[model samples]
Target: MWTGNFWKQAAERAVKTFAQASLALLTGDGMGVLDVNWGDVASVGALAAIASLLTSIVTSTVGEPNDPSAVRRTNP
Candidate 1:
C-alpha cells in the first residue's frame, strides 16, 4: 500500500470498477437513455470504486508486500 506500484494498481482497479458500475447502470434496465438518472449512476460508481479500493487494501496483506494485485510471489 505504501509503494507507488501498489497505489497505481489500486487506482486502476477502482477506475475499472467505476466504469463497470456506470455501464451497468446505464444498460441494465429497459429505461431509455434519456431517462437514466445520472446522479444515481455517479453515486453507484463512486461506491463501487470505494469498495474496490477497500478490497485491495484488505487483500494486500496476503500478496507481495510491494504489489497490491499479487496474491503471492512464486519461486523461480
Candidate 2:
C-alpha cells in the first residue's frame, strides 16, 4: 500500500528525526556513556536494513547491480 510519496515522506521524516536526535546529544554537553539501549536511533537501523535489502534485491534480480551501467565503446 505504498505510493511514491510514502518513500519520500519516510526518508524526510527519518532525516528530521536523526537531526533532532543529534542535536539533543550534542546539546546535552556529553550525555556520556550510561549503557543505553538506543532504540530511538531507528533511522540508522532503517538505513542499514534498507541498504542490505536493496543490495540483496538488486544483486539477486540483476547481476552486479552495484556496477556501473554502461556500454563499452571500442576505438576504431
Candidate 3:
C-alpha cells in the first residue's frame, strides 16, 4: 500500500539531497562564489519530484501478492 509515509519520505529525500548539493556547490566556490542560478535549482528539484512521483505510481499500481500461492505462481 502506498501510504502517506511513502510520499513524505520521498519528498524529504529530494529536499535533503537538493540542499546538500547546493551547499556543496556554495562551499566549493570559495570567496569568489558566483551567483547560484535559480533555474538550476528548480531543475534539480523538478527532476527529484518527477522521480519520486514515478516510483510511487509504479509501486502503488503493482502491489505485492496477497497469498503465498500467488507468489509461487509468479515465480515458478
Top candidate on TM-score is 1
> Mind giving the per-residue lDDT tens digits that candidate 1 earns over 1-76?
7888989999999999999999998889768989999999999999999999998998888778866664786799
The list of candidate 2 runs beyond 4 A from truth reads 30-76
Candidate 2, residue 13: how far the Cα is off, in Å: 0.5
lDDT: which is higher, 1 or 2? 1
Q: What is the TM-score of each candidate against the true structure?
A: 0.87, 0.38, 0.47
lDDT by residue for model 2 (1-76), tens: 1345434544554555566665565455455545433564455555654654444434432432232212234579
Residues 1-76, candidate 3: write the lDDT tens digits: 3456656755665576667665665566563335766677567656665665566555543444321111233465
Q: Name the candidate, 1 or 3, with the larger TM-score value.
A: 1
Worst 10 residues of 1 by lDDT: 65-74
User: Pick by lDDT: which candidate is best?
Assistant: 1
Q: Which has the better lDDT: candidate 1, or candidate 3?
A: 1
Cα error, candidate 2, residue 5 (Å):
0.4
Q: RMSD, each candidate, Å?
A: 1.7, 11.8, 7.5
Ranked by lDDT from best down, the candidates are 1, 3, 2
